[model samples]
Target: MPQPVLSLDALRALDAIARKGSFAAAAEALYKVPSALSYTIAKLEQDLGVQLFDRSRQRAQLTSAGLLLLEQGRELLQASQRLEEQVRQLDSGWEQRLRIVVDTIMPWAPLWQLSADFTALERFTRLQFSEQVMAGTWEALLRDRCDMALGLAGEGVNAQVELHLLGYAEFAFAVPPTHPLAQRVATTPDEPVRREELLAFTAVVVADSAAEMPGRDSGLFAAGHVLQVPTMQAKIAAQLAGIGVGFLPVHLIQQELLTQQLVVLTTEIPRAPVPLYLGWRKDVVTGQACRWWREHLLNLPWQQLLTPGELKAHV
Candidate 1:
């Protein structure tokens, strides 16, 4: 890789000059002589062959090139400062970074609150969240793509991960009230919907986000056509639009059920509640930050809807 022509010192000097609005003032703020700051800028300009400042002006003002550098340079400065802080705080047993993968079926509003609560601890661990589907959630930990996973299915339990049963999410076969299936359920009221009759309709299913592993889907009962959506929201939207029919998380569609926009139909063969899991890599030693997250998140409503009742105490 080519060596950078501009150093951190050069960026700092440029930033200070721009912010302080004068070489003398910037030098004072930096605890250096005015000429020292001048020499640093001059050296940077010489190496890059760019006129960083307009000397023709009475007061020190940056040229167009200098303004662009300052724009990107400030971001670099903030990143460097954060890196320094993380390095300094590493002895506290907090990870420098924490990557979490959540299944798309889980509600995200609670997770956002969980992240905010983590930030309040000020551990200097950078938190990242990714939403995956089915096998994709499990593979994230297997591939070491993320530090921890929430809503992993119990199908592929391995030595690589330590998992906890988050809980079972009850699913219902919901379709828009205008749908033929809904009308059929309304007419019969007592008889369970036959699986063979469902074979003629389209089923909306959440597509597994697995990149390397084989993708798998759930709650599909031999629908003649399949419409795979990226997330639960899309699946819900598809069902609400009367375009397809499939099982959906009961908790997620409470409002639709209450409003009569969507109605749940009894099936001849009912889908068992799906088990969701919380998992992390077993190979690596966990840090305080990881443990902290594990504790807080387990208490939040991953097992239930994105409710505030449990999340408030943790937050």
Candidate 2:
């Protein structure tokens, strides 16, 4: 007998089934009937002469062999997709998809209007958005996970990417009015709280979004206990609940400051404003769609883009 040959269609069927959880669901995704997938996968199994999915489970759980095949198969599928996308860009100036990653500190509502404006152009490009915190923004760009990064922060950006400064943002050390820090500031309004005193209390900080690489700590000291939250919003919530104290973006907590839901505590040394940037990989071809997005984002006012709209409403 000859060795088994794998077809793209069969691989697609295998991928869809594994991802979608069941044959019926995969069929729906592939726009084919359940029977068709079952038949195709069955034929593949016959050709390979090995079990892929364990039949004993209710869901289409892959066997060890199937998982191995899938791991490689997904890479092939992704390459094929990239090839197709490149072809589309060559034929037309627009990319089929543009991935945009924004720092969590950046407010996304402004882009909602811009997205609607882009649709008016009738460009075939699709917009995808992701939010990253601190070093995670840089990591996403370095990992080739995103086409464009907005509000990216840190020291000098990587040489591989073109960087544009959006603006600088100031952070305020905020805590609930009932917290000791608040009382300290209120009693001695002129004096800034020392680092030792600040570190003695728990710090609420946003967890960095990077997965493979170790993420950097943004605001906390080595000696202090930390309350880690996934996003800036969560950190704000933690601070408002008086769980911990740390510097938060001033623009983000305007409403909280106004309503006294959270109050600013002066620190011994104020944090210097962080410079936010817009960046994209230097080597990757910048298609028209990507350029359009980059230009549009760069044109927006940084303060306006970062400010939470309902600062009138507190935590």
Candidate 3:
């Protein structure tokens, strides 16, 4: 009699073993006991008539046959995931579950309102927000882990992805109220301040993946005199302490600007406004819930959200 084919559950068990390097780890990841996982793997090997793992060592290692099986297993898993994604997308309209990723810098109030509008349309609608940096958002969209993403336009934005420009936000050179720029009138397009004027001041910049600084090569800001801080909130605190002048999102500083805690630099250099894009995979079909949220964002009057001066301060 011929051996039976391996089951999807068996393939999953083997793949998990390969990924986790031990039966115990795989079992934990799969929410199964080690013995159960071992039994599944043993059954799989029996069906294939070949040993999938070298059981001699403390950690499970893939045999040559195991390696070959692993490659095929991964392909099968990916196909299964894709199929499930398609089915989920088709049926998601009635389910009310919407997964979305947004840039960390995106305003929270507007997003809350967007969610409220979506839920009002369908009370069962649910929103999941994944906070990621510029590049990570695109990755989430491509992986089908998220239905939509909002982020700044960047080079890695795939051509296969669809991007909608929500609006442009100006970048402003901000400093404490006591800073020299605080005393001067805001800079205009024709009279933009020279880079040399900024060099004399210290610049506190956000560091690491959390930071949303503009592309360095874009000539949007001077790169040499930067003091790298970790988070946007920390950068703001540094500015308040009068440590340095850093480029900040205009909307984020609205309260500071009004209370005289922060002041915008006056320069002829045009405010470098970064265009924000709402991105989604071009090939993925969105459900009604996703469509409703997208249209809600498109219809938002962003102009009314911030003052004209605040908008120009950053761009």
RMSD of each: 5.8, 10.8, 12.6
Where's the lowest-lDDT run of ten residues in candidate 3? 210-219
Q: Which stretches of candidate 1 lie over 4 Å from their true place?
A: 1-18, 21-24, 33-76, 89-96, 119-126, 155-157, 207-216, 222-230, 306-315
Top candidate by lDDT? 1
Q: Model 1, poorest ten-residue lDDT window?
A: 306-315
TM-score of each: 0.76, 0.66, 0.56
Q: Residue 16's C-alpha lDDT in candidate 1?
A: 91
Q: The CA-based lDDT of model 2 is what?
A: 0.82
Please give, for residues 187-220, the per-residue lDDT of candidate 3 as tens digits.
Answer: 3334445677777776676543423333232223
Residue 39 in candidate 1, Cα distance off native in Å: 5.6
Which digits, one per residue and each the tens of the lDDT, describe model 1 over residues 187-236? 77777779898888998989888899998876667879999889988999
Q: Please write out the lDDT profile of model 2 over residues 1-315, one tens digit for every residue.
A: 976578889999999988888999999999999999999999988888888989996666799999988999889889888777668765888878889998988776778988999989866677899999888998899899999998888765578989998877778777888888778777777777787886677888788888877787666654378888888888899888888888888777777787888876666767777888999999998789899988888888876545434321111
Q: What would the TM-score be for candidate 1 when compared with the true structure?
A: 0.76
Q: Model 3 segments beyond 4 Å from truth?
A: 1-92, 121-125, 154-157, 180-194, 208-225, 229-231, 268-270, 303-307, 310-315
**Residue runs of model 2 more than 4 Å from their true location after superposition:** 1-90, 303-315
Q: Sort all candidates by TM-score, best to worst.
A: 1, 2, 3
